[model samples]
Target: MKNKMTSHYAAKLLTASLLLLANYAFASDIVFICHKGNALNAKEIRTAYTAYFDEPKIVDNKALRPKLLQYLNMSEHQYKKMWEKQYFRRALTPPVVKKDDREVVDYVESHDAGVGYVAEVPHGADVEVCGK
Candidate 1:
């Protein structure tokens, strides 16, 4: 009985921690990043990401996904629906999903037309900030 109670409390603590972490991530500032010479501004970045631009896009799934969606003025469900429609109707592939900011930066660095959002851009990476 004591063991079970301990485990239950532990689980509750973990769940609370995760919820707090998620809220922190959501509240954190995000930045739009692109290839070093890309000329996308904040407004253009919004349109490019929400619309079906030909340029490659990277999504950092950890801390930035929900925040980016919020910036794009959509929810996760809405974003998925949009991508699904694009994929099924127009055969447009969705943005590539990266594990974290580092991979997102790396992808944008290599692709001339790449764009992505991150919680924070790493130091010394050759990426341009489109907007915050």
Candidate 2:
């Protein structure tokens, strides 16, 4: 009886562990990052992404582009169209697109007013996480 109970508990524990892993696999939080000493609120970050704020140059990781657009309540097509229109009307530059987190961190670190988003907040000293 003791052995059977132990086996049952082990099975339950394994199932729980698997569930937790699956949840973590599907859940990724995007952290907004900027050059150290440059802080921005959510509104400011949104404006920067939309090219409304030219002070901070915006960098975007291509992988998280969809997630960022969804956060802004926009589809990828709509976001591109809006930027296109803004470019024609205002000659605003689009966000700099980077391949991954490392590149983004490097860019933001080099540019004092650079801002970007990453799937996970980097542990580097050069960047500050402004929002999540």
RMSD of each: 7.0, 6.6
- List the candidates' TM-scores in order: 0.71, 0.75
Candidate 2 regions with alpha-carbon error over 4 angstroms = 1-28
Which tens-of-lDDT digit does each residue in 1-132 have in candidate 1? 999999999999999999988866674568788898875876677766665765656455565787877666688889889888877876767888888889898989998888888878899989998854
TM-score of candidate 2 against the unseen true structure = 0.75
Q: Tell me how far the alpha carbon of residue 125 in candidate 2 is from the true structure, in angstroms, after superposition.
A: 4.1
After TM-score superposition, the amount by which residue 28's alpha carbon in candidate 1 deviates from its true location, in angstroms, is: 7.3
Candidate 1 regions with alpha-carbon error over 4 angstroms: 1-28, 56-60
Return the TM-score for candidate 1, rounded to 2 decimals.
0.71
- How many residue pairs clash in all the candidates, one count each? 0, 0
For each candidate in the order shown, give its overall lDDT on alpha carbons.
Answer: 0.78, 0.83
lDDT by residue (tens digit), candidate 2, 61-122? 99888778766767888898988988888888888899999899899889989999888766
Pairs with steric clashes in candidate 2:
none
